[model samples]
Target: MVRALVVGATRGLGASLTRQYASKASSTVFATTRSSVPKDFPENVKWLSGVDLQKPKVGDDLAGQLKGEKPLDLVIITAGRFTTEDFNDKGPNWDEEVTMYTTSSIAPVFLVHALFHAGLLSKGSKVVLVSSESGSITLRHESEGGGNYAHHASKAALNMVGRLLSLDLKDAGVVVSIIHPGFMRSDMTKGVGFDKFWDDGGAVTTDDAASSLVEWTEKLDISKTGEYWAPRGPGDIGTAEATLGKGLSTPLKLPWRWLLRKAISVILLRDTALVWSLLRFRTRTAIYDKTLFVKCGLPLAVPADQDAGDDAQADDPDGHATGDDETLAMG
Candidate 1:
């Protein structure tokens, strides 16, 4: 039998996920809420009330509640708080930013640590951190402009936390998935004045998003752990076309690796002596490993061998200095 826990399960995607898991035969579902249990919440689903993610002791409270239960097969943290911000007179509210960060990023670390220490998360356990496309710097484009700093940055921090947790738990056979659950038509969105974009933004019902997430979770494994994904694809990502280009596919994976590549390219471009040393040592077996070049910072196509003649060719590819070689030599 599978045991699943859905944090922040009073409403929206969390509630839907809890109900979905509870509906499955031979599956036990647990849910956490900051307030008292809702009247119509699924009878089969166990509830942990007064579980506020903003509080420092939230993790300990959860661990205490599920102390002796079977190890959870799945743990989904969906507690999130978003507040709009801008450079106008209203500006960014300090309280809102702190709350957003605490709920979305800081709390999950403690919650996962508590679970791991309590033996609630064992081998083969799947931990899903619900992030947002707003977390993606690549996805942010001029089209959307700027605002909601706290909401966006908080999710970004959550993504980093998820990645670190994955590395820490990899040896334990735990899979941590960071995901941007699709934009949804819920009170959370409505509260943030995003309802205007609901029609144009391709926002779906929370239940629909939950269904896609549940299906995706069922298929998730160690091979793709620590990756950020959008189970409903780029349909709702407004900047997908402007930022990532068109002709995209479903289960849209965020391009974090692209950022790493760009960073490496910047480093190689900035460090002239490093590139020069690499070129000089190209012939040496110890230094000229093509795999190492690929992994490190060589974004350009590398020739098989750079003999004296090839070096001459590279230095003056068009039979001219091109200034690049002169700059490299000066370094």
Candidate 2:
């Protein structure tokens, strides 16, 4: 009787995740794509339209559906775009960066907002944001080969957005987690040379990613909200025993009364962006001041970190970001 909704269910990792849930027989899956649903999709799957990741309707449509149907047990955001270069800097192809960020990062957060607004996810509903370690600031420092800025920043933004959602929904017992799927062979990485990941060789399969995610998700405890995880480990990532006093344990200390206050703030409020800006500013200020060497009381701004608030505002002067596929032939 579990119900799941998957955005971008027509291809790649999204399709793989949808198949796993639909085939389980215990789930009623709603699969969405901008164009057509696959002919081979399972019988339990319902196909819907108007869920393009780049548009506001993506969240609105899914929220309407979830409000009308049974409450969603799990919602997965898998719509994404990738590029070898940061399209913004890679001139003549900047649309690629816009597309990547809109699909992979911005849209997923909006999807969560819609669900919250519609009251579609009951207490304890689970949400998954498919992120990548390529988005990890921790991992980027260790990358031997430099590049992939657009894809990397988009995923990192996705992670931060997940954290933001967790802050809003944690009190409702809703669990949100960001998952890092290891390198896989897919359209996103097409034409990229990797002899070891050749079709004939030992490459990670989409099915493997889906199965691993489900296995870990199934075993997750209620207390493990707002955590990032990989499929490579042994013990559960969200448990006190696993982390032994890390970030995952912080939420457990928040009083239940605080969650009540948050739920009220969410329901009675319309200033979502204002709330987000303030919270992000607070978090960034705390982290930057503590981590970076401050000179003249101002944190040193790195060239690569070029003022996101300014750039995002400048890039979308009209206040609406467009999708990469907007100009593509959907037919």
Candidate 3:
């Protein structure tokens, strides 16, 4: 059976993915955690301990766990933390701050490197980095309040690392990609506006988000390596084409099917609008023509038209001045 490793799989999206893969995919899942896992987790899931991904030996421990099992299939790095306060709120300078960001940004790349070094992701394997738009340099112009320095920086660093790894792993047949999970209603963002979030279609349930993300990842072509994805759906990428090309570190190429579909959709929409406009215009013209003819005292043109005139006349046949029979017939 296929095998997959999900780093940071204790809660939220990771936990949901654990459930999803266990229920849906026929694979032995290794869910990584720093401490304990809930008792209610699925039976097929193996909760591995001490997954300090930022440090060494993480890949080794993972490799050892899967040594006698089925071939390694996929690796998803979803381990992350968010601190709204300063970098060193609880502890002293840079160590805590550095570790937090490094785990998110730097460590995953090294983990992939370690995996390849150990021949785990030899070929036909995939790696996904659960990143955030908060790390995007393109979004810096739009950021407000900017206090989560370590979190933001770490994510940005993670973006860079994911891109580089995508390039490095391209020839190895390992597809590397990054995904933004949006503002999910999880322990990570407790007491945040849940109602407004769903109203705006931004906050997604962990199950919904995981299912969609896995579907997107599974649908990725060899051409989509190194692309940035928003779990909220498509069209939010800053430079999708450019990023897709470089991030995978392969020759720059576009998904021609995507371009073709977009062009066709645009054409079909234009045609549909034009057809509707023409039909509406014709309907309005017909209505105006009939109204004007009736007001000008011209003979009714259709059976329904004649009936309307006859009905009006029956209501007040003599109310309207009876003109000559020939003129009234012509009208």
Candidate 4:
């Protein structure tokens, strides 16, 4: 049987994802909620209510509860908080930024770590983190401008979290995916006053966005682990066309391969620096040789045509040329 766990399942995409999983007869779905009194969820779904991701005890409690359950077939952390910020606002909102970073990125580490240790995660398990395209530095364009520093930065940090987690889990045959779950016309967007741009933003209903995300997650495998993708594809990404151009596909490659490429780059740079230093050293040695000869007022060496014998000994009485050759060799 397929066992699925969806965290932060009270509303929005999380709720829809939970519903999708519950609809499958072969699946036993578990969901989480931060609320002590969350609106009732479906009867088929097991609810882990009061599972606040911001707190460590929450993970400990949840891990203990699921210890005897089947190694989770799937785990998706959908907890996220977005707060808009602009230069016009009264400085930066430190509290909101911390919430965004902790919930969206930092919490996942401890949660996953605890679950794995508790035997809730095993080989062939898939972990998904619902990040956003806004996290992508390459995807950002000047046309959209910038204001939500915490929102964007949190997602970026989450992407790194996913990458490192993927590396850690790969040897165990577990796959980790980071995804932009697509834009949705949900209360979260409305609360952020993004409804004004809803039409232009190509926002869809939460159900529709969640459907695509569910489908995308279904296709995940250990081989495709450690990737960033948009479940709904580039169609919904506002900056996709502007920044990435057309016809770009994602879930691309080994996330750590880029670091390998960078290491290769460093080697190349080191070789280049070494060559440059040697050239500089040689030039300096040549300059010093000329200066030394001039400063010492040493007589020029005998012409090549002037063969040695008694005359050569008389010309280099001080043996300065021999000492100069030794200096050049040392240099």
Candidate 5:
């Protein structure tokens, strides 16, 4: 029998996943909610109430509640909080940012750790962290502009947490998947004024997203653990065409190369002394030349020469250079 747990299962995708899992034969579904269990909740699903992710002891609370339960074959953390922000009018709200980070990023670490220590997660188990495409730095474009700092950064932090968890559990035969469950027409998005982009973004119902996630998790294993994926593809990613080009494939793997290159670029750009030292050592072998940039997954164009009209593009004609002159091309 498959024992699955869906955190934040009161509504939206989490609720849908709980229902679907409960319907499956030989499956036991467990769901968590911060409030009382809703009326007419699925009879088969075992609901655990008062499970707020923001609380510091949330993980311990959950582990204690499920102490005698069967080991979980799959665990999906779907809790999230979002708040809009803009520099011109609505600036970042400290309280909202704290709540968002705590719910989305911070809680997952504690929750998973407690579960592992409690022996709720065993070998061959799968852990899914429900992140967003907004977490992807490479997918960010000029079209989206800048705002919602905490909303975006929190998801990014969750992605990193997922990757680290995957590494830690690899030898234990546990798989950790970080995924963008696609744009969904949910209260969360509607409350954030994303409803305007629903039609244009190809946003689907929560049930649809949940279905895809369940199917995707079925195929997940140790081989693809630690990877970030968009199970519903780039159709809803506004910058997909502008940043990654057209005719993109489904279940897109958000690249880690861009993250690597951006990190290196940020270091070089912020530290003038480091940049100067690298420039001074330009007379060294080819390894010290543009090779270092290439190895770090950075653009071949030297950072010092960015303003020299050196707009080097990727070899692919469909590709484009980012504002920082980073080359992004579809493989």
Candidate 6:
């Protein structure tokens, strides 16, 4: 049997992936929930309770459940919490801050350590840790200014854990991956009051996110170990366009192809404006040359008068003649 475990499989991506994995033939899926067992667990899928990742012993608890079993084919840790922070709270609230890191970042280190020591993950097993792009230091831009200090930093630390885990597990032929499951519409996001960003942030349903992740995980091997991926691609990632450049990283063709075309049109319009300005400048120069010849009596028909005008200018060498010349040019 292709045995797979979805850690923290209570709701959202974890729950959806549990259902997705069970849909496959010849697969027995195991999932974990903290306490509540939604009455709708999939048939043939086992649920493990008391698996809070914050506690290091939780891994040992999980190992006890799957003890004596074949090494797991896939292990995914998806249990995490996000906490909002205030920059000016007068003082930092250590409890919530610590809980955020413990839940999202620190626990995965020992949890995986426990499982590895317990022999729950065998050679060729795939270990997937659900990390977010929020963890991506590269993806951070000025658009998302602010605090969620632990929430963001924990994921970054988790990414580092994944990288280290990949190195440690490589000799055993185990593959590890850290991933951004796309912007998901879930309780974690909603609870943190980010629901207002749901639509604009390109947030997707957990089902869609799970489908992409399962498909990607199914094909994962050592070649992709320690790499981060967005199974849904860049469609829902708000920073992708700004950071990776428009259209280049998205799942579909750029939604506003016209915007690029409009940009080109503006450039062409600018060039045309420049050409028109240059033409007007040259035309004015030619007109001024013609007018000066006439006004200064330098035209072929007035060359004799030009000498008289020059003589007239010599007569008022002081200033009157120069003023007259200026008046003639203006006229």
lDDT against true structure, model 6: 0.74
lDDT of 3 by residue, 1-331 (tens): 5578898898888999888888855677888887666678888888888777766677677666556554467788988876555425543346657777777977786678777777778677888889876676444433244456787778877777877788888887888877786557677756433344454444667888788777766776557677666755423333443323234322212221233333334554567666455445544553322332343333433533333444344223423323333222210
The TM-score of predicted model 1 comes to 0.82
List candidate 4 stretches off by more than 4 Å. 250-331
| Model 3 ranges off by over 4 Å | 86-93, 191-201, 234-331
Task: Order the candidates by TM-score, highest first.
Answer: 1, 5, 4, 6, 2, 3
Where does model 2 exceed 4 Å of error? 86-92, 191-202, 234-331
- Clash pairs, model 4 backbone: none
Worst 10 residues of 3 by lDDT: 249-258
For every candidate in turn, the CA RMSD to the true structure comes to 8.4, 15.5, 20.7, 16.5, 8.2, 21.3
What lDDT score goes with residue 54 in model 4? 81
| Overall lDDT per candidate, in order of appearance | 0.84, 0.65, 0.64, 0.75, 0.84, 0.74
Candidate 1: misplaced stretches above 4 Å?
260-331
Candidate achieving higher lDDT, 3 or 4? 4
Pairwise lDDT winner, candidates 1 and 2: 1
Could you tell me the C-alpha RMSD of candidate 3 in Å? 20.7
Of 1 and 4, which scores higher on TM-score?
1
Q: Candidate 6 residues 191-310, lDDT tens each?
A: 988899999888999999998888788888888787777777887777777755665542322121223333334554567666456445544542222232233332123322233434
Q: Give the CA lDDT, 0 to 100, for residue 281 in model 3.
A: 56
Kindly indicate the candidate among 1 and 6 with the higher TM-score: 1
- The reply for model 6, stretches above 4 Å from the true place, is 89-92, 250-331
lDDT (tens digit, per residue) of candidate 4 on 1-331: 7799998888898998888888888899998877763555667898887788788677787887686888999999998998888877555699988999999998999889888888888998999998887887666668888789999989988988987899999988889998888778989999999888789888999899888877777788876687777767776778776654467664322122222233334554567666455445544542222222232332234334434453443224533343333222210
CA-RMSD of model 6: 21.3
